[model samples]
Target: MVARERERGFERFITFVDAIVAIAITLLVLPLVELTAELDDYGSVSGLLRENQAEIWAFLLSFAVIARLWFVQHDAVEHVVAHDKRVERLLLLWALTIVFLPFPTSLVAEAPEEPATKLLYIGSMVLSTMLLTHIDLLLVRHPELTDGNGDADPVDGAANVAMLVLALLITLLVPATHYFPLLLLLAADPVARAWHRLRGGGSRSAREGD
Candidate 1:
């Protein structure tokens, strides 16, 4: 009975977290929706879209970011059969970052050149990724909380954190770069694979496969 209750509680917690993430992602598009109110000021729909391209780009970028983060969080907790206070706290904090993302995303649309805007936008992502990495580490350390799947890997999360940190640095240091530095995230998987190999995880997996 106790075990079942614990699982139920964890399920409720995951559901709550998923709801928050959904709301946050939905919020990312609100700014773009508001852009419709100004359609009368522009010559045509194309003109309005052209003028507000920054807003559209910001919305799309943040939507992708939040989606990716959600996926990572889901993977991290997929096998978790129980939750501890630490995991709960970390997840809540991570959700807070997701909730805060839209504000900075708007700032980016309004003033993409401002170092402060870049810092706020990218900084939120950095913090979010860091929290995720921490959660992954926690899962790795506490396998008993999971189904003994042994599939929790922190390398991908760590690589994502590293890339986002690099992206933040590049954007802050090179104002001309704008948000282009975010493309670094595309390399995260390759970096994770390399890191995993360096740690002999790949070799062990291959040996097991053989």
Candidate 2:
């Protein structure tokens, strides 16, 4: 009975996390709705779209990022067989990170030109990614919390962290062209693979594409 209850509790926790993430993602679209509503009174749709292209880009970027994070969390937790107090705390922190994302997304849409805005957005993403990766690593270490089938590729995590650091550095060094370095994120997998090969380690399949 205790084992079953434990599993149920973990399932409930996962469900809660999923629900929070869903709400956060939904909230990201609200700004776009408001933007459109405001533009409705104005002239041409194309003109309005062109004028608000920054918001559109911000929304698209944030939406894609959130979706990816959700996928990673979902995938990472699939191997979970049980949980403890530590996992519960981490989950709460992770959920909080997800909840906080919409604020930065909005800031990006509203003030993409601001260095602080870009830094906040990128930093939020980095923090969330790091949290999720840490959770996965924790699960791998504590096999009792998960099925033995759980596998985490530390190389991928390292590569992702490196990419985020690069983005952060670019934002700090060249505020005007910070996003240019972020584009390098798309090449993270290749970089990780090359890094592993150079270190005489076998390359593993990437979790997902950029």
Candidate 3:
């Protein structure tokens, strides 16, 4: 019963954190209000927009990408409904990345080409991926938390962590290499689903991309 209460508390906290993350992305666009200076002419306004073109695109891309990552994490945890130390720590790490993302998004929007901003972006992604893989590990190793047959070769958890580490290391290339490994998130889902099917676990709604 105590564990159940803690799990409820954790879910409540996660809901709060998710709401804050949603608001932060919305705020990213709010800063662009400065783009409209004292210019009255339409052509002059267009020029101002052109001058800030890169910032706009960078913000939009980061916003969309972060939204995607957040959704994936949410789905990973949705049916989990637990709060043991392992799950708690993983959720906290996920929350940390969600909270940390806005600052880097703002920095990139202001200076997308700057190395610090780019590295920060990569680091945030790496942290997020690590936490997600941690979730997978918890579910895999602790049969109490899952169907007990969804994961095999727990090495999958290790591979997920290694993939994120490689991507993080490649951040030396800054913004250019930052998103290269993000595709792995989607790819892992199919691979994991296939493994579960082979193991006779069948496809869960979450893994089916619902």
What ranges in model 2 sit over 4 Å off? 1-6, 198-210
Error of 2 at 185 (Å): 2.3
On residues 82-143, what C-alpha lDDT tens digit does candidate 1 reach at each position? Answer: 86889999999999999999999989889889988988898998898888888878988887
- By summed lDDT, the worst window of 10 consecutive residues in model 3 runs over 146-155
**Candidate 1: minimum summed lDDT over ten consecutive residues — where?**
201-210
Per-residue lDDT, model 3, residue 167, is 61
User: CA lDDT of 137 in candidate 1?
Assistant: 86
Q: For each candidate, C-alpha RMSD in Å? A: 3.4, 3.6, 5.0
Instruction: Give the per-residue lDDT digits (tens) of candidate 3, residues 66-154.
Output: 78667766656655655567776777778778777778877876666576766787678767766776786667667565433343233
Clashing pairs in 2: none
Worst lDDT 10-window in candidate 2: 201-210
lDDT head-to-head 2 vs 3, winner: 2
User: What do the candidate models score in CA lDDT, each in turn?
Assistant: 0.85, 0.75, 0.64
Per lDDT, what order, best first?
A: 1, 2, 3
Candidate 1 to truth, TM: 0.92
What tens digits encode model 2's per-residue C-alpha lDDT throughout 1-210? 233223888888899889999999899888778867766666778888888887788788878888877876776677786867777787788788888888888787777668787778888878777777787677767877876665666566667778988887887778778466767677777888777668876644433332
